[model samples]
Target: MTKQSSTDEQGDSQSGSARSWWLKGLALCGFLAAIGVGYYFFADQLSLKAIAEKESALQEYRQAHPVLVYVLAFGLYAMVTGLSLPGAVPLSLAYGWFFDLVPAIILVSFASTTGATIAFLVSRYLLRDIVKSKFGERLSTFEESLESEGPFYLFTLRLIPAVPFFVLNIVMGLTPIRVVTFWWVSQLGMLAGTIVYVYAGHTVPSITELAEQGASGILSRQLIIAFIVLGTFPLVVKYAMKRWKGTDARN
Candidate 1:
């Protein structure tokens, strides 16, 4: 009877492992399919140049079907960002042009953070082991930073463009940070940058004009103010950390 029970337990374990592998494979296929569709079908449509050409048409469509346009825009923004594609900036600018500032900001913030969290989850569940296997030594530094600094390290990364946003999402996924922490930190950190992009879209006469001015045009007084905030954010974080540590020591 004992030998028979041991054989059954081993069979069950093997079956469970096989099931897990199948699920992971399915998920990887779905992810790749989404990426392929986004790249081939949607990438060009999301470009500023494409939007520039259809500006009048888009404006007309928005005016005719305001609610539908808003819903579609939000979904598209979320999907594009979730896939870590290249259309996020164009989408942001387009939203600002189509919608009012407050609406634009709200939509962009929630959609972006939501999409980022999706990417984070995907990395954590699907790609974490593969990534760790390949880059374990290099990734140890990030793991240590996340372990010691917790959400602050993530917050700083979100606030500053030091790391590409998508890369940060993927890297953070491999860490021990809670999903809720990742969501809120991403939402708040990306808020300022979102405002800048949306505001630029709102103010620009046309996408063509924005393209021509490029980074040069974006560096106006407002952008300089944003830079100042970015520069001082680290000092503020340092001060807060020091105070927190002092309090801990006292306890």
Candidate 2:
């Protein structure tokens, strides 16, 4: 009777495990489908050229349906970022053009961060285990380093405009960092860059001029200051961390 009971327990456990895997598979499939649909329908519409072409109509619509436009804009921005697709740059600029600096900043900052968090969660849910299985030994050092100073590294990457944020979001998700930590760090880390981009979008006379100028035209004093901060941030953080560690060790 005990052996029979044990066998039944094993079967139940297996069934439960299978059901869990089945749910995960379904979720992944749904996520991919959403990406496919989004890319198919909205990818081209997300570009600067598209925004330029529809600039007048977009402006008129935004003026007429300000609240609705704001809600849709936020949703679209979050969806695009969450999918880890291209065009966040154009979207940021578009928002800047559509709204005032403060509003644009508020919208872009929260929306981008929300989207990033979604991507991060998706990567973690779907890919982290696979990554660990395939590259655990190789990534051990990296994982350890990230565990120790993940926020700082994440912040540094976020501060630099050259580093691609989508890639950063996905890679960091594979680490052992907590979800809350990822969200907050991303929110704060990406703020400076968001402000710069949104402000540029707001200040540009036309999206066509922005496209033609190719981001170089947006290199105003604010951008320069941002660049300077980006340059020095890593070094300063590294020194401070080292000093703190030394003090802790002495204590």
165-215: candidate 1 lDDT, tens digit per residue: 888888778888889999998898888789888887887767776666665
lDDT of 1: 0.84
lDDT of 2 by residue, 65-123 (tens): 98999899999999999998788989998789779889999999999999999988887
* lDDT of model 2, residue 54: 89
Off by over 4 Å in 2: 130-141, 161-163, 244-251
Worst 10 residues of 2 by lDDT: 134-143
Deviation in angstroms for 172 in model 2? 2.3
Top candidate when judged by TM-score against the true structure: 1
Cα error, candidate 2, residue 50 (Å): 0.5
User: What would the TM-scores of all predictions be?
Assistant: 0.91, 0.89
